[model samples]
Target chain A: MIKAFIALVRRDLLLAFRHRAEWFNPLLFFGMIVTLFPLGVSPEASVLRVMAPGVIWIAVLLAGLFSLDSMFRSDFDDGALEQMVLSPYPLPLLVLAKVLAHWLVSGLPMLLMAPLLALLMTMPQDGIAMLEWTLLVGTPLLSLTGSIGVALTVGLRRGGVLLTLIVLPLYIPVLIFSTNAVSAAVAGLPMGGQLDFLLALLVLALTLAPFATAQALRISLS
Target chain B: MWNAIWVFFHKWASPRYFYRLSGAVIPWLWALTLLLLLGGLYLGLFVAPPDYQQGQSYRIIFVHVPSAWMSLFIYTFMAVLSGIYLIWNIKLADVMVRSSAMLGASFTFLALATGSLWGKPMWGAWWVWDARLTSELILLFLYLGYLALVNAIEDTRTAARAGGVLILVGVVNIPIIHYSVEWWNTLHQGATVTKLDKPSIHVSMLIPLLLMAGAFQLYYFSLVLMRARVELLEREWRSEWVREMMGRGSDG
Candidate 1:
């Protein structure tokens, strides 16, 4: 079972790796959104520094959302999902594998790119580290929770906007903790508390969200 | 005793039985609701002494508190019904969920509207991004989203299953909404009734609040049963029992 799970994860990673443009669109989109923030706000470094955490967090969130719709879409289209459901391996593990691949492709790249964006926004050095660290813990929660949304909407004819409407509110708690963590880090306050809170949220989402996502897939397949 | 309870539950699980049973109970339920609402409103508006600080405008709690309580109560009820539907795969539970969604949305709307009305008098504004208020607003959005999801899907079974899943997912937000004020520094006031040891409100105030809460419960039941009957008809239109029901209605 473990072998099958690793194989599925590896296969999804290879598929994501082969489609290089699919991987880059979210990065480019993230860069473009970060640039737009400087244009929309004043060009002053102080102002950008004040808004940096919020701006960077929102950009990463949008990039994560953009990549989410494709999580199960391609598999559903080509009958791969049906085969997976029928396979000897458990469906929930398959879902977890796909979510891991999604994080690797979409979430990790955005986290790695945060420092560069932080420099663009004139964020303090500690703030950049906090942003990267929070994303490291928080974005996986987003990916897992978001897979539930993606699975729920996969069978719909046009689910893009509806998916956003359904999922964005769920993202609010994560947004609050992640941005607050960065803010705490920037102010040189004790951030251990907020980081622990984010980790708690991540743990909670990791435990419950996959079951819900797997159930949603069953409903869609039916 | 177990057999008897099972029989009772199973009987209600039949839509026809539920429709007939609800028809018998709804008139009494409506009458109770009307009596309690009128009595509660009169006492709350005029008889109950005004607050030492906020004055007569605090009377808005007559409507607002009941609506807030109803919103939370109904969502918990809906979640339980969704759980039943998931476990039993009973079509009746699905119909109950469809019926409850509209009523839940109505109560959520009442909570928001009356909250705004109260806010204008107290906070000198119609809206504030207070934590409790924002969470309640999100609750309204969740309701609307659930309704839209169910209506968008054409297949009845698919709609029920999908809507059920959405409700289950959205249930996570309810606790967050309830505790938002306590967890965060916000403009909204803290709890008056939900405290563990003692409720903060005076007995005179608490009495009318309890009465109005009872009225809201009956109001929800009367409306949900009425709507569930209609939902049953639409879902079972092709069944023999529905044909017989239609024929009997025509003959009468």
Candidate 2:
């Protein structure tokens, strides 16, 4: 099972790298969204400082949304997903492997780029660490939860808009907690509670989402 | 008793039997709904004394509270129906699930609209990012998501089963979402007074609230059953019972 998991993850990662443009799409999109906030909202440091946490998290969210299609779209198109479903190994394990690879390609780039974007937003120095921490915990949750949505819509012809409507609601709590934690840190307040909440939600998404995704994949593919 | 219960469920599972049973039960439900709505409206709007704090505008609670409650109640009801459909693969359960989503979305919309109307007079703003209000809005989105998913899929049974998975996911997340929003609200707002946190209301106000709640429950059942029957007929149109019913000229 472990070997299958690694092999699936490696295969996905290799596929992601070979495409090159698709993996870079989310990072470029994330950068563009973060940059737009200053022009659309304001360039004032004080205003941006207050809005920084929410702005960054929302950008991360939209970027995650942008990349979700790549998680299962290729494999599903080429019939690799059907093969995975019929393999001797459990489907949830394989689904989790795909989600992990997705997070590494899409979610990790956003996490790495967030601090630079934070500085661009004039976010306070003290909050950067907390922002990174929240992303570290929150982004995986996004990937795991989002896989369920992607799997459900994998078979649809025009699933992009419908996918956003379905999955964005599920991401609200993560956005709330992560932004709250960063804002608290910026204000020199204790952010432990919000971080803890994010961690709890991550744990939840980690355990339940893979099975739900596998089930949804079956339903969609059927 | 166990054997009888099992037999009852088995009979109820049949689409034709369910069509007849709901046909018989809906008139009573509609009658009860009418009675309760009239009584509750009279009591809630007129006989109930004015609040010391907000006077006449507080009467909106009669409509607002019940609609909000029904919104949550119907989502939960959908989740349970979805669970049954997923576990037993019962066709009727899936029909009910399909029938319930639109009603749930309407109630959620009603809740948000009424709550906003009430807020404008009371809070001096049409909307506030209060925890209850935000969570209700998110609940509305969840309902819309379910509807969108059901519409997007071409195959009916597959759409329903996929919708079941979405509902189960939403149900599990609702509490956590509510709590996180509440905590976030408090962190920013420093404990504002919650609008509906009535610990000790007088009997006069409480009576109409409960009456309205009962009225909403009956109305929901009546409508859901009516919709369920229509859905059942549409899905089972090729079945012999449906053809016979059509030939019988819509005898309810």
Candidate 3:
């Protein structure tokens, strides 16, 4: 079982590496959104500083969304997913492995790019580490929760907009906590409470999302 | 007792039997709903004394509170039915979930709309980002998402099962959303009736409130049953029972 899980993760990562555009698209998209916020909202450093946490978190979310469609699409198109479902290993384990690979490709790049974006946005230096912490904790939650939406819509021809509608509501709590934690950090206030909530959400998503995603994949494939 | 409950579910599990049973139950439900709604409205709008505080505007609670309650109730109800459908493949459970989605959405909308109207006079704005209001808005979005997903899928069985998964996911998130929103900000009043302790409301206000709540529940049942019956016909058109019923008359 562990071998299958490792093999699937390694396979997905290799495929993601080969398709370099998949890795760069989300990063480029994230950068573009951060740039757009300054142009679209304001160039004032104080305003951007105040808005930075929310702006960055929202960017991560949208960028994560941009990449979520690929999680199962290629495998599903080529019939690899059907075989995974039929494999003797429990489906959720395989689904979790794929999610881990997806977060690595799509979610982790956003984390690395955050400091540059934060600098560009004039975000306070104190908050940068907290921002990274929030992303470290919260981005996987995004991938896990988002895979459920992607899996549900995998079989459909026009699931792009519908995917946003269904999944965004579920993302609200994560958005609330992570943004609060970052802002608290910027203010030099106690952020333990908010970070704790984000961690709790992460744990919840980690445990349950794989099963739900697995079930959704089965339903979509059926 | 468990045997009796199992027997009841087994009997109602059949589309034909459920259709016949719901046909018999819906009229009584409608009649009772009409009675409760009229009596509740009369007592609430006329007999209930004007509030010393907000006066006539506070009366919107008669509509707002019950609609909010029904919105949450119906969503949870649909989740339970969907859970049954997923586990046992109960056709009627799927039909009920399908029938209940729009009704739930409408109730969620009504709650938000009425809350907005009430907020205008009370809160001095049409909408406030209060915790209760935000969660209710999210609830509306969840309903819309469910509807969009179900409609997007071409196959009925696939749609039903997919919707089941979606609703179950939504149900799990609702409390988390509610708490996080509350933690972020809370301007809306706390629960007056639903708390475990005796309701904080005056007896005069409580009576009509209860009456309206009962009316909403009955109305939901009547409408969902009517919609479920139509859904059953659409789903089971290839079956003999539907053919026989079609030949009889337009009336169920």
Top model number, DockQ: 3
Residue-by-residue lDDT tens digits, candidate 1, B1-252: 999998999987898888788889999999999999898887887789999999988888888988888887787788888888988888899998899988888998999999999899889999988887877777777888888878877889988988888888889756753453335447888789989999999988988888888889899998988999899999888998889988999999
Give the per-residue lDDT digits (tens) of candidate 3, residues B62-102: 99999999999999999999999999998889999999999
In model 2, residue pairs whose N, Cα or C atoms come closer than 3 Å (at least 3 residues apart or on different chains), thus clashing, are none
Candidate 2 per-residue lDDT, tens place, B23-124, comes to: 999999999999999999999998999999989998998998899899999999999999999998999999999999999999999999998998888888
DockQ of candidate 1, scored on C-alphas against the true complex (2 decimals): 0.60
State each model's TM-score restricted to chain B.
0.94, 0.93, 0.96
Candidate 1 pairs with clashing backbones:
none
Please write out the lDDT profile of model 3 over residues A42-136, one tens digit for every residue: 99999999999999999988988899989999999999999999999999999999999999999888999999999998877879999999999
DockQ ranking of the models = 3, 2, 1
Candidate that scores best on lDDT: 3
In model 1, the Cα lDDT at residue A17 comes to 88
Q: List TM-scores for all candidates, in order.
A: 0.96, 0.96, 0.98
- Give native contacts recovered, as a fraction, per prediction: 0.49, 0.92, 1.00
Query: What's the residue-level lDDT of A175 in candidate 1?
Result: 78
**CA lDDT of each prediction against the hidden true structure:** 0.86, 0.91, 0.94
